[model samples]
Target: MTIRPLPDTLVNQIAAGEVVERPASVVKELVENALDAGGTRIDIDLEEGGVRLIRIRDNGGGMPGDELPLAVSRHATSKIASLDDLEGVATLGFRGEALPSIASVSRFSISSRRTDDDHGHVLEIDGGRVGDVVPTAHPEGTTVEVRDLFFNVPARRKFLRAERTELGHIEDWLRQLALARPDVELRVSHNGKVSRRWKGESDLLSGMRLHEALGEAFRDAALRVDHAAAGLRLHGWIAQPAYNRASTDQQYLFVNGRAVRDRSVAHAVRQAYADVLFHGRHPAYVLFLELDPRRVDVNVHPAKHEVRFRDVRLIHDFVYRTLHEALAGTRAGTPSGAGVMPADNGPAPSPASPGIGGMTSASGYMPQAPLGLQVAETRAGYAALYGGLPAQATHDASTVAGPPQALPDSGDATLPPLGYALAQLHGIYILAQTAEGLVVVDMHAAHERIGYEKLKCAHDGEGLRTQPLLVPSSLAVSEREADVAEREAATLAELGFEVTRSGPQSLALRSVPALLAHGDVEALLRDVLADLREHGESRRVAAARDELLATMACHGAVRANRRLTLPEMNALLREMEATERSGQCNHGRPTWARFSLPEIDRWFLRGR
Candidate 1:
């Protein structure tokens, strides 16, 4: 067979195979087109999950009669003109492959009349067979009707899922779009009944729109993150670690207003929450990254769901550091000005921020401030608790004096977030009274976080400690692995591993990090090498060190059932206030909870 040029119809059908996977994909393409056309109000009608019919009407700047035919022609778009334009393309639909692709796979009709045209015109196409453009009714916008989708391709039709499942996909994509463009009004109808509507709000995404798009739960527990530094702007809402989900379904990351799934971004987020979140749980966030268009590539894939950044490491570090600062003391039980709505439909309420050191609550709380930023030898006695020792010295018999001091309800208004500990309940919970309400703390978990943070600080202050092995274990590996071992020797040394290439495909591990002395050294080295080869850096070594420190903190923290006097209890409360991330333990379990006065009053029907 000779090299032959494919016909336009067949070529479009092939593109459709990628651009239009299901009704949802078609809906995405059409809605994006409408958005690019400056549509403020878009109405989408679907039948049988958009298989039978998908009609989208947008009050946008419609095309003239002359452009109706060009609309279905492949590679024809108003978004970009040249290679330089392609590099900085910002519109949602720029490839110009969606229109012709969908038209070739189904019976498509595009009727439109520009603001300047005298009347509307309709162009019909059956499986890429173009029809004559005829004059139609007057209209100042475009209305596209797609019927019998995938009728020409039986295989494509068979791959479609159930109506409900397909509808779910469409709804999910619409919700994502709603998040990015809160200024665009969107309405959806399925099976002839209006199912959902998102009213356009201000340019910012928050309040009712955010709650409707994500959920009320996420909105209530969200923290506003607006940080611009290092030539990038990251702004969005990040939920508290306590209010996490089982999966990353709620994490909506938008790069220049386009939703994408980039591994580097995801990994950065994961690393940011590494020390705070519980194991086996995921975070919920709606973040948007805005940067120079030239620094990122959006035309890497046909679906445009992935992107390549010019400075991936810089992006990773920025996202990680920003989120880390936001969550610094969120779990530490600090009286923060974090906005929290009512969990139920009862009524909206605000969080009572505990003012520190007699400072005004409104003007006092700073997330970036050091919680336990004292200039003490943090690690000298930090791990003593891991050995069943108290985090602080045990209170002497004279320390208790009389009974637990009563917390002030008035007069002394600058109360700490955790308040003063009144008593230890059941040798586990430290019950205290705060100016806002009551606070119950899991002593073990709280101390664990405190001790863990100190241990980490100490570990960082003093560089990694290397434990030399007497035997100097030798391991066999591939030539590539051996090359990596030799190349990354300096990086390995920084991570407290001294590795030397012994032979063509062998390495000698002379020492390892003291914290990971008992771990499987050979396996750990292999994993590190693989990480370095892929990510240009290895987190496994740091992760291993942190894991060891966590275990030490867990064992060293105050044990449940250990009786404590009033002074010891109060001392613990003060330490918690001074410690960062005291809201949860090292493993992500919440360390404390505050029950506002109204919450406690509701239990007893105070007013009613």
Candidate 2:
């Protein structure tokens, strides 16, 4: 057989295979077209979970009668006309293939009337067969009807899931659109019965939309994030660390208003939460990253669900640093409105002010001596239990001591976030009182976080320690990996690695981070190289160091079943309030929980 150009219909059917995977795919394309047309309100009607019929009506700028035929033609798009236009596309639908591709696989009709037109016009297509355009009556907008999706292609039709499953996919896509475009109003009906409606919101960052989409709990736990720098802006809501999920179903990322999945940004978020999140838990977030269109390519995927960033390392670092700083305020006792934990009803207490000897006036308990003396008294006891104070403890024990002062009154406005410790519960938990109500703290968990933060500070101050290997280890890798290792040698050195390329596809690892010297050196190098090649940076070394430090802190922390006096407990509470990311322990478990007075009253029926 001789090679020949594929016929128009055949060519269209082939393209349909990529653009029309299922009914949900059809919805995505059409809805995106509506959004690009400046549609403020959209109505979606579906039957048989959009498998039998899908009609989308949008009150947007509509095309003229003459443009109807061309609108359904392949490669005929008004979104872009040249390579430069494609490079910096801002609209959602630019390929122009979505309309024709979708038309070829299903029975489709489009009716539209521009605001200035005397009448509307309609065009129809049946299984790749185009029909003549005819006059019709329509409102000042566009309405697209797609019927019997995949009817002409039995093989493709067979692959579609059950009605409920297909509808679920469509609903999920709509939810994503709703999040990205809160300004657009959307209404949906299934089999003639209304299913959902999202009213248009004037405020793009309205919490009502978040509550409607994710539920009340996430809305309440949401932390507003808005920061701009270096030609990039990231704004959205992130669930507090304590409100984590078991899966990543709630993670939503949009780049320049288009919903997409970017591994680098996702990894940055994960790293930001590494110090506070539980080992197996995932955080929930709805984030939008905005950068110059030239800096990102959205044409990478046919479905437009992925993008290629020009500077992966810059994006990663920016996201990581921004979120890292934001989460640092998760220190225990922050006001509810401050994005940490929610405060209970009543006047929000003022943040604790620095008091004598580095203690806060809000602690409400006066120690008998300087904080340093207290640590010295407990140093011998801790040494007897855990061998000796770690280097971090030794450093802190020397500097934290200051002259003691009188405690504040219980009703003072500057009450510490955790309040003054009332007593120890079973030697494991600290019971305290606040203006709001009760606060129960897991002593061991709280101390572990406190110690872990101190250890990190000490380690950072001293800089990363490198351990030289007596015999350099040789690592065989791909040529690309070797090239990346060589190019990123400076970055590697900053991460406590001393690697040099010995051959075209090999590396000589002379040293590793001192903290991870006992672990797998070659494997670690390979992982770091992989990250560098893909993300232009690597956090493997830092993650490993943090894990080791976490273990040491856990061992050094105060254990359960140990009694504590009011002053000792109060000191611990003050330290928690001052420490970063102290709301949770090193392992991500929340160190304390607040039980507001209203909730306690309901539990005991005190008001009744």
**Per-prediction RMSD in angstroms?**
5.9, 5.1
TM-scores of the candidates in the order shown: 0.88, 0.91
Best by TM-score: 2
lDDT by residue (tens digit), candidate 1, 1-608: 89999998999999998889999899889988998899999999999999999999998999988898998899999999999999998888898899999999999999997898888999999999999999999568899999999999998899999999999999999999999999989999999999999999885444467888877777777877879998999988888888899988999999999999988888888878888888889999999999999899999989989999988868887888898877774645554333431121111111122211121222232222212212123345534323432344353445343544565563366666666667889999999888778899998888777667766666676666788999999999999999988988999998888999999999999999876788797899899898776555667888887887788777667778876665556556665666666678989898888899999999999999
lDDT of 2 by residue, 66-145 (tens): 99999999999999999999999999989899989999989999999999999999999998899999999999889999
What is the C-alpha RMSD, rounded to one decimal, of candidate 1?
5.9
Candidate 2 regions exceeding 4 Å error are: 204-207, 337-411
Top of the candidates by lDDT: 2
Q: Residue 474, candidate 1: how far off, in angstroms?
A: 4.2
lDDT of each: 0.79, 0.82
For candidate 2, give the lDDT of residue 460: 66
